[model samples]
Target: MPHVEKAVKDWQQQFAGLKTSAANLMQIAFPPLEIMQSPTGCCETRLHWQDQDSEASGYVCIDDFVQATLQFENVPHSVAGQALDEVFGLGWFNGAELGVRQAGEGVYYWTDETNAAEWEVSVLPGGLANLSIEYTNAPDIATLLDALHTAYEDPHEDDAAT
Candidate 1:
């Protein structure tokens, strides 16, 4: 297997624009490996973390990152089909519909099928366009942010003399 630590760092570099510091990125499990595949084909990755908020009632905190069917069936296939294949790969069908939801203190990427990829780009709570790219492997959230930021940043350099 590739060096997971390096991979995580690489991902961080790719998404530095999101302002995701190494400290914040290190808080979550790295290279979210798949733990199990249910009979229905749903996959789940377990993230283990210690709740820093001592005031909370819970002791150990475990977050389940689940991937199911896509949630947005109403979205035309024509829009998602080619894009999905190009970004993910061939043979990986759109298992779940794509949709967004606020879960706990953060947002999660969800699908309607047991196995599928979801892509969503929207303005986040802070007014930054949050672009999410999710796949079977670790979703490169940082890379997406960096790319989006670079794409949208004002290109014109201040040249008052011109």
Candidate 2:
């Protein structure tokens, strides 16, 4: 079996409680997982999401989008294949107006006229998956982090008795 446990633990800190856009993306991308924070303030999760891609037909797609990056953990190879199908199916037959291309065995690229993103998947020995997402020409992730910090500030701090 692969070193799925330790591998996920390594990244789990960074994957723990997210804020702003990061939290939003986490909610959308991994609806089944719980976003928690470690004592050290890093993100963590234990749920493994199976890959899912379907020819979704709706007006809910993005428009003039600048950028987006989505990451996941413990995904299976079979799920990866399913995601590949979803991306290609939308690109080729659904008039989704996006570009999809395979970069290598476990790498895929999705892009449009003004935005670009990549999905890289690495499978551990036990068939566990580690996925990394990167995006260009989109909102900075730091912005999301900042939003989280800002939300935690006390509203009455400035008004405290002098």
Runs with alpha carbons beyond 4 Å of true place in candidate 1: 1-23, 26-63, 66-115, 120-139, 154-162
Model 1 C-alpha lDDT per residue in residues 8-91, reported as the tens digit of each score: 999766655332332133234222212232332322222222213321110111123322111222211222232332343433
TM-score of 2: 0.35
Q: For residues 1-162, could you state the per-residue lDDT of candidate 2 as single tens digits?
A: 369888888665544432334445534443433434343222222122333343211101111232334354554433433344343443431222232212223334344434445544454444333445456322433232233223222222342111
Q: How accurate is candidate 1 locally (lDDT)?
A: 0.29
Winner by lDDT: 2
Candidate 2, 109: how far from true, in Å?
Answer: 4.4
Query: What TM-score does model 1 achieve against the real structure?
Result: 0.22
